[model samples]
Target: MPSLRMFGRDWKVAVDDLAVYAGVAGLWHVVWVIVEIVFLARATAESDQPCIDSEIHLFTWYMSVDIVCFLLYALLLFYTLRGSILDVGARKPAIYILYGISAIYTFLLVINIAASVLKNQFVAPCQDAHRERLALAIFICHWIFWGVWALAALLAFDPFATTSVEQRYAARLWLLKCCSAGASEARPGAAEHIGEICDRAYSTQDEKMESSTPMSQIGALMTLVFTGVDMTTTDYATALILVRNAQRMDREDALAAGVGKPEVAPIPLDMLEDAAHYLPHALSIYGWASNVLNKQDIAAWGCGASCVAPCTGKDVHVGDNMLFSSKNMTIQGVKVMTKSNPETDLLYMSWDNEIQGLLPYYICIDRPRREVIISVRGSLSAADWMTDLLVLPVEVDANFLGCDPSSMVAPEDVKIETTASRRRLISAHKGMLGCAKTIAADLRRHKVLDAVLKSDQHAREALKHDIYKQDCSDHQLVVVGHSLGAGVAALLALHLRSVYPGTRCWAYAPPGGLMSPELSAAMRDYCTSVVCGRDLVPRLSLSNMEILARQMIECSARCKQPKVRVILHPGKKWKRDDLFKPEAEMSADARKTLEAYMRNSGSSHCAGGKVIEARDFLTPGKLLYYEANDSDIADALVFTPQFVDNKEFAKNGMLISTFAVDMHMPWMYQMAVDKALDDAHRGLPSTRVEVAKLEGTCYAPEAAAQTTQQAETDIEAAGGRPS
Candidate 1:
């Protein structure tokens, strides 16, 4: 149980460490063999005799070096796996010997590379000349391999004496495998030895977490990135460690407070129908705004032929009643909203202006529905995708929401039950919040709301059309978007709610980590989030991603070594389906680990100390999950859209579902909504009939009646008449 030290610091060495060393050395030996063969061929071709003594001596020396290194690496691997070299007294010496061998091999390779380059450029050239070039090429490749091997050794052994929590965890996992191997050999005290190492490693990491600041950790991550580590992998590992530590802290806090799981109720049929009604409106805007709708399609909607492109066959048709022509929509009132002219004053006015900018959105008046719709397009440009990846929560300030400074109140003065408001700080997704603020400011600066109201008044006073005759105040302000746009739409709705009390948001496939749970809950009355099947976006968050990483690591630990492929024939084509099965079965241990992790980390808790809160960032507002029913008969496929009482609907964040990405498509949501409506009209029984009955609900005639009544009530509350 003694701490194994290298130089002045402690080291955690394991037999599994031999794997990296052996693999690198094996590759170098293979390259050395190829170089020697080329040299031998050149020597034989130049001489009339079979061989020259000097050339033969040089080739023999090269082969000898390669064979000796190969044998040494194989011997070390054999002893390490056998638990002979893992003895506490011998492990340090064994590692040192391995390092010595690598150094000697690298020194010899460098000499050979220099000699070959000199001969190729300045020395007497061979008769064929091609063999000399081949030797030079192999020498260069060998030097590259040597550089990689040296870097691997440095990182694997921590030669610089700097270690991180991620490195410690990786070392511990490696030791765990070594211990398993030792136990199979019945090596005495192996389990206890590994356990002690793990305990020390965990305590060291905990101490580091307690003392370190987020800024320092971020700086260290940057340093690692510059030092040859993959930036994405390093970032993910750092985030995962931080989240896991935070989760542990949160669990302790929850246990101390005696808190338990909260109760979750079933969703009502009326809410499902309400979300369905706006589904088409939310989806159709993307097509029109992105220029997927052709000139003919826009002209068919009674708008002039301003569009240039021919029909692309991707035009979104949402019935003749729904109008989304460029003439009807304006971006900052500076330009008619079109794909070719989407630029606005607020386009490059955000923090992310360096990387493109906020996606352009349009405001249009829906005369038939008496609604002023602000439709934000989903992630299309690089800026939009960048916005999606900026999941870090930033404090929501008055300026960020385009709020009037005079109207702002202190946290203590506000009587809201939400924690964010009470604490005087609201946080939202950094990128999405920025986009929301820019959009809000542009709307206010352009006086777009006033323009809409004036247009309504003008229509009523002059045109006197029945649809346009509705009172200006009666026009509902609705914000609709999909994917990244959906998140921004949710935040925009919250900001505008104070000024425009009747503002509503229809967020389709919005990110799961858009806002704090309390902030999300507060917006339920005004916002509706539509999720289809097992869409990944609505389930993606820091906590969920950490859980996924843990599951993957556990699965990797249980995975057996893959069978080596032996290709005996050339030009043999493999069947694509046979090579890559779509429906691969997961190992039993992996499945169990996945289930256990999900069950354990499905609750919210306050994470104190230096750790960021492991709190779940919930989807804003009432969540309507459209679970697709699997049926062999495509004609008999049923839709099951229902309101979810808790975020559990998106809790299983595993990316195992084949439809995870497909489900996030706007068309998928539209199709689901359409089918749900058809089922409601037909009074078809729900797929979850038993659960619906248990909840005293039926998706038949009675449910349809309730939906109608609820829609009327909602319309009356909004100061408008039902259609």
Candidate 2:
């Protein structure tokens, strides 16, 4: 017989162990049952009511017998069963049955004691069944015996990797927790080789030395190392068609004077026809989907991947219609298994959790097309992260960069430096530059300071590896983000354009001044930005906000509060408020701390690459209040008031707040392609297409489409169709 030891080389999961434990528990219950029967009968004979109520007495007998037989059956099965416990399919079901039987028996036992007391209530006191305390203990003992049997059965089966789903979720969960707790303790080169660490965490039986890394020290670097991919995935051809000949914002000071273009770039015809005119409806996916983020208000871990739950368009509202969720949203042909991280969107925004670092965003692979979509969630519903992003420097520090290649720190040194230098460096630096050090320290730990400074990470390398493992072809990555996520996507695209393959970015309603002239020129060939007409988001200049920040800083200094103030929103003029406003007000000390960062970081915020403008897509269905009188109702205006001057927009609807926010909706920005196309085809002169300027040899579908359109017009004039 095998030794009954629980550990040290000889510990094996065996059916014999189950047999031994169950047999002991069954024997205990059987003996208890025999004692209970004798006590019950003897007590009944001594009672003034010679027979206890037959129904209650019979129930007691049945329950005792059923329990003893149930244990006996379990013992027999364990002794007779063969092969590995992991191979057994009925184990989990059987264990659940045992648990249910125990619960029912316990409930009935309580009733048996209650019924015995009631029947003897009218009888003499000397022979009361309730007074027989010693006899009741035996029944109580048997009830506990059944509980023991259930527990034994539980350990006998494997719950991690079941027959139906082979994934060991518990192992993965533990791995995520451990790695998140202390990612730096992991060995050198661990960032590039996370699969090996995962294997160690998954296998409890492996005695290998490599698997010895404690669960809490799982490769946490994986969270920081892969950072994110760089691409927006919007078409450049359509962007060119919309903004080619459209007026450009030449005056940098125009935004400062509260001047904006209400009749901004319109969607082009080619893209409108691309989606079969369902472009506006399709665009709501971002706005509506973003609204689905379940922020939990937890610090650092505020937003998680929990919002990843499948979205159906049933609940979303868009112009008395619903988005075609079932039709257009199957990025994958069918639902694929994803790691379930069930938490609120707020908790996912956590920057603090080690187990779940940065919410562990997904790289969703479309199996058919072999395309990988890296989804980065936008700001949480609450303004916490938006505020943090403000305090947190927008650009990486220049001092932390350019470590000499020849004098590079060793991989082991990086792990050491992350732990030691992080706190010291943060303390040494003050304000935004200091805060920037803390961020730099995190990057230093993962040895990706250079990568993150450039918004480029090992995302492509890891993505390619995942594809190879899945036996999929190597292709380009498509990145899509909204609001804050759009800015991140653009930053990612700028650095990866020359380095990575198939680099395309589709920034939807991205913020203004985020683009620098160099980056704008660099990404022009491939990056396409879609902006809703008069949507204040893309029109919001960083210059105005910077001026506000400086004023707040100096105001604090004058008030003997040396503390500077930090607030990021349009300065009262063109003031618009809505969800994801990214507005905030902070102390002067905070303001001064981030002052250098504000000065050096993105000074301008405008659409990069080719800009596609959607005209009044977000404008309300019909004006709530119209300008024309009832006498001339036909031309009463079909949309909201188009205020060209920024100050004019602010005056109406409690200042242009309505006009500024009205067009920024994701559903509105979604139709830029269609609106531009409609505008081009609206009338004779409107039929003119904008021709784009090119610096490199790039294909222009607009040029070809125009040539064809002009030829067809000539044919139509001659009474002939050019088809």
Candidate 3:
């Protein structure tokens, strides 16, 4: 109850203060509002006096509304604060100001009310001089207090002071523009940031050495007024120091004006060695790993004209001396480190920073007619296994007919003894350059009949046919391969073209076959190659195959009709052997033809005329290898076997060779239509009444004999020893 009484007393005091504040503020505002409102309303009336009358009434009504609003506002404040006595710290200052204004206005209102009453009373009495004088004094004090309160409110929301130096400068510029035109034409609140606007303008002028302008003078004056206050603030002080330092630097440059032309040095090959000094960081290892094909020592790997050009000449295949400098040398940015078991020493290469998942790493650069030879005869570490059991091939029965099928399978426990071996035989052994030798030999031995016979045998056959038909007058040849395949293909194309100048192979994805860049370059124009993306299996050299190939095609003198493309086949479907499937089963007639073809082909699998691998498609006694090409044109040939079911197998493991055998049902049915088509196309012309005329056709043996005889004759004509 005592607490209630104390609250009640405070409430009364607040009420008294609010009443006084309202009365003083309302006095002039009421009159002003009434006059304005009366004039505005009366402007539409019949008489001109209505304007004056309307203005006066409107002023009175507006001021009275304000007084009522204030009284209500005071009550609202009391309600808002009653729940929290000491927690309104942020609101306390505003509350106090409001209380003071309210109290003064309420007092003025009381006096005004008293004057009305006294005026009515004293007018009749005419002798109340003391009361009349006291009324005048109260009126004068009311206006004075009103003026002071207005000024205080303006100060509380001081618009000149921005919280930070950056903002202050921004605001100051905004103000200066408004002040220049006296603010009537200025935007709203433009006057608020006058100080900020002036500061920026002056600062800008100072930066440009136009500090002597009139605007700068005004800016200096404004700064003087606010300097002391802002200097005390840490942020503004730091900003000022920074600006001053910038000014000093600008001045120092002005003092040392030198002869004007910018300096640049002449670049030559000699400077390349200086650039290579810092090759350690740029390369995967310390010493330069020369590309065996080209014999050029690449300073670094990957592209970046800016990073590499300073030390090494802009060309990627430069001497390591140029890349050794710290300026140009950098790690090959192309390498992507995969997040795997860190304890393990395996890092997979990705096109970018990280390999996506469990996909195999395959790097392919497709180029033709020019070559990028890498010589990675550096410190290569050899990794060997503990036992041969892990490395040996495992065999399982083709059929599940064994009595104890699981027991028949051998466990991986058998071991073979082996010794570690290393030999540095690279000094004289021809590397990928041997590929050229192989190609040359093949060309020398191959006849036109052989070319036609072997042509279009596989996808590579299609590529060879295209090469033969190509307009090689401008650009002769391109050789392409992936992994070790690329190296062989490149070498073959280059060597073949070097002697004959009639072939090209667009080689891609080459292994680092043992050949120097110089040797490869010497013979590569006859064959070009490209490497599309990063495949670390082929050691990354300073000069990338793709880039070098492209450069040669674009810039080299002897590289005729250059056609090298470094293409990235991310998920290309390479195998296309599903050519034998069809809608209906193999008919009785078609099955017979297929059987004959499989049994009588009798082609050797290698250069030595040895039997083909058991698992080769043509071989009958083994499972399908189901792998891509692995040998030369004839050697790498694939012949599909006749499909048969388990029941068709005889006790001796040979197929029964009967159409009605249940084991032959699936294949017979699956390939019926294709087999029929094959028969129709392959049928003998003598058997047909009318047929397409075949040209340049002959038996393999007859053609080989003719080719051998012709070659001997050519040798004899040239006065060489004939076989």
Cα lDDT of model 3 by residue, 216-244, tens digit: 33233323223211221222222222222
Off by over 4 Å in 2: 1-361, 366-370, 383-468, 471-474, 546-655, 671-723
CA lDDT of each prediction against the hidden true structure: 0.50, 0.32, 0.27
The backbone clash count of each candidate, in order, is 0, 51, 103
Error of 1 at 147 (Å): 6.8
Rank order (by lDDT, best first): 1, 2, 3
What ranking emerges by TM-score with the best candidate at the front? Answer: 1, 2, 3
lDDT of 1 at 280: 48
Candidate 3 Cα errors over 4 Å, as ranges: 1-436, 449-477, 502-505, 523-527, 540-723
How well does candidate 2 score on lDDT at residue 270?
Answer: 44
Candidate 1: TM-score? 0.55
Q: Which 10 consecutive residues of model 1 have the lowest summed lDDT?
A: 562-571
Q: What does the lDDT read for residue 571 in candidate 1?
A: 20
Report the CA-based lDDT of candidate 2 relative to the real structure: 0.32
